[model samples]
Target: MASVQRRLSALLFGVALAGTTLAGTASAHVRYVVDDPADVGSIVSFVASTLAVPAHAAIVGGSALATATGLLAFRRVRPFQRDRDVFADAMADYRDLLPWLLRLAIGIPLVGAGFSGYYFTPLLESDARLLFIGLGFLLLFGLATRLVAAVGLLLYLAGVAVDAVLLLQFEYVGGFLALVLVGSGRPSADDVLERVASDDDSTYARVDPVHALATRFRERVAPAEPYAPVAIRLSLAGAFVYLGLVEKLLNPGYALAVVAKYDLTAIVPVAPELWVVGAALAEIAVGVVLAVGLYTRAAAGLSLVLFTLTLFGLPDDPVLAHLSLFGLASALVITGAGPFSVDELLRTRSASPEDPDA
Candidate 1:
């Protein structure tokens, strides 16, 4: 058991800290490290010009047609329908992993921020690295999970109060809240201790620490578990929208700087100004889709694709800072839109009127 704990600790540290710290050029915490351009065209002008480009207009129309056709095919075809059901069922089977994933989503970024010399946002310098690191490792260990998450949230809120730049990493709010709602998951020390405490036959049962208190704490918050997905989705959506609108659209100069720095226009064969505008529009659209829970899995899958493309295309972007977004997206793919979502309402309406079970 001691050796197993050691291995887990080692693995967590290696992935959360060592791997990220070793990457020299990676520094994207909302592109904070990117230098601003001396001057740039207005976002409105860029958008207007892109709309005037015949090739760009054709590509947009073609994409919309393809998406609509694909959706229709999935609905009409037996194999496609069967595959969708099978994939959803597979995802549902692993619902127990949600908490652990949320923990990692919140924890890894905290550890990364601490090690990377930031205070939740790369824009804000950090002086409490050990505090963040300690809270992070505790969450990863799944010990005092709820308490740790709550503390993390409080610290983040305090940081936001100090510097609004923390808002750029606002997705952390959803992750921490979700962890508070769901608590620790399987393969965690908390789960192991709880099991031990429940089993009278086990030698360590009587001395199991924290399990009883943790149980009472979790039970108190059990009623809100259904909203976990809501919190995560909304938070992620907000971050995407904020990044697109406030960061890119309103601050086109810096965004255009990013485009030119990475030479994104060369890869896409579009004007550099159009690249900034197009990205802003795409991100806003993604956020809106996620917020509504319309084709949620598809949106999340696209989010993963977007994150991957960004990581590969812009080599300087911090892989660690974006790890939380990846975890959240993966969680959504697993959980979908839980309650209070358009998907839930649609599902209910689609159920058979005479025999809903069927």
Candidate 2:
């Protein structure tokens, strides 16, 4: 039953991916915006003149037929349930084919549609950065599974969010989600079960903490390990602080004017200079807290609020700088410094009173 369900699920997912790709391709080509604007008379004329509808129809029809064939293949494999063992064996057989079908359905259309869209859409040329970003995301999804590439996915999604806000082009978010789903859906339940069944008993032997600690201390930390969430958070915080300072330095008069315009005195109902001082101090304090991973969540939250306000209040400038700061703020809020954090150290100490560090 599980095997049948898995096969059915694979077929459905493949069909869905194909349908989405076809729709995206059709939308890309059969639009008024694709044609030469100077020669265009009316919207309808532009669309009709540019779109190769017959070609699109032929491609989509072929894809639909292929999807139907995949479904039929799945149905043909459904009746081999002689026993539990036979069912398991049949599922194993299906798994081999199903992943390949999914790869085909998802990959071929994305590449084809991406190329068609890139060539046909004038907007993509105007905003080449976004096009490159989208292509990078698709390539990343193809190269690595989402679980192993979670950090990369997170970064890409962050970039997408910032781009969406700046350009008001929200479709990229949907594309990002689709890529994530495709990359993350690879390892099924049967794969996990097989891995567990194949585990060696000796590998589960108890560890000596003293020896473990000695080994850890003696060995140099691996470079890849620094790419973990906590390290990323600290690095991101430092970058944000540096960028913000650079912005302040470049436009010192403007920065001071912004501080004055907000009327910190009236808002705080206290000494005006003190209020300005407090805000400045708070910015520095939050950066320090984030750097040391102390009160990380609170620090990140504060930083987010500060950056959001800056994004709205600052003078209209290049979109990239604003978006980059916003992305960093969002990342800090979402990740909140992982294991290599002062907050974690405190939590560990509190949880275990017997520890020497505690």
Candidate 3:
């Protein structure tokens, strides 16, 4: 389901319009930049045509078969368990960085959106540039992080209500909610203030106004902190699914336009239909695997690869727009699946003495 997430730069008029035009060229979304791109005929027809090609069908089938075989082999052999456990331990030790990682993921995009003259997404121009920039800086600094994240989330929700396009980056909602639950990690203003406030005789504690509210907020929300990964995973998976299923498969014209405009088939030397359908299917598969928490870290790795490939594959794709996805994927590689995940279930089941084979 990884089909979507557009750029934040679009033009209006005058000098600013010119700036928008220039900025938009850096955007990766062909639909936004192209005038009227070719549709990939009908989705069904295009898919059938691709599959009808014996070579294409064999390629797709072989890939799926290989993937299935690999998964089964990994389960049965469980090779490199010691090294894997070491890597897992290493990842666990860095859990404190999770809050900062989330902030970087969501905050950088908000700032990019502000500077690009669009709202939360490229679907609409924004008037609140300074506001978004300000909030982004605050989140980046880890200053009043929870409050800023809350504000960011509220503003995003409001925008979504009006246009529904903001849903394209719905992961921001999860990121914000997770921030509110997790608070700022070490070395942040919030963390320092909390420490100072906890000290009854600290001189700085008397002037720290946010410390009490932060403490109270933490006490109330701390219980839900474990679900942060759940929110992020589901939100990201939904975004990917929408992008793959709706933006690419249903509205194939924009993608086909991009393919033709860029002559992408020349790069890979494949039918454009195969390229589009292949990408859509890859995205959907990644999203489903991620949603189910199967090899969570591995899924994140694939996400990183896909995002990077899109950036390089489409020379004009906006680098800024993909920053959030990149950040989120990196964070997931660190955090893995939280509660309410198959990863958790498997871990619990594997711990049972009666299930020694597991």
**Predicted candidate 1 versus true structure: per-residue lDDT over 212-265, tens digit per residue:** 777777776666676677777776677677667777777788877887777788
Those runs of model 3 whose alpha carbons end farther than 4 Å from true positions after fitting are 1-35, 351-358
CA lDDT of each prediction against the hidden true structure: 0.71, 0.37, 0.70
Overall local distance difference test of candidate 3 = 0.70
Measured with C-alpha atoms, the lDDT of residue 62 in candidate 3 is: 84
Best to worst by lDDT, what's the order? 1, 3, 2
Cα lDDT, model 1, residue 241:
73
Q: How many collisions between residues are there in candidate 1?
A: 1
List candidate 2 segments past 4 Å from native. Answer: 1-131, 136-227, 249-251, 260-278, 315-334, 352-358
Q: Tens digit of lDDT per residue, candidate 3, span 151-265?
A: 8878876887687656566667667867877887876877776777889899888887767777777786665676677666666666566567666677677778888887889
Model 2 Cα displacement at 230 (Å)?
A: 2.1
Q: Which ten residues in a row have the lowest lDDT in candidate 2?
A: 23-32
Which candidate should be chosen as best, given lDDT against the real structure? 1
Clashes of each: 1, 0, 13
How would you encode candidate 2's per-residue C-alpha lDDT over 79-112 as one tens digit per residue? 3334533433543454333222333323333243
Question: What overall lDDT, based on C-alpha atoms, would model 1 receive against the true structure?
Answer: 0.71
Rate residue 9 of model 2 by lDDT. Answer: 42
Model 1 / residue 44 / CA error / Å? 4.4
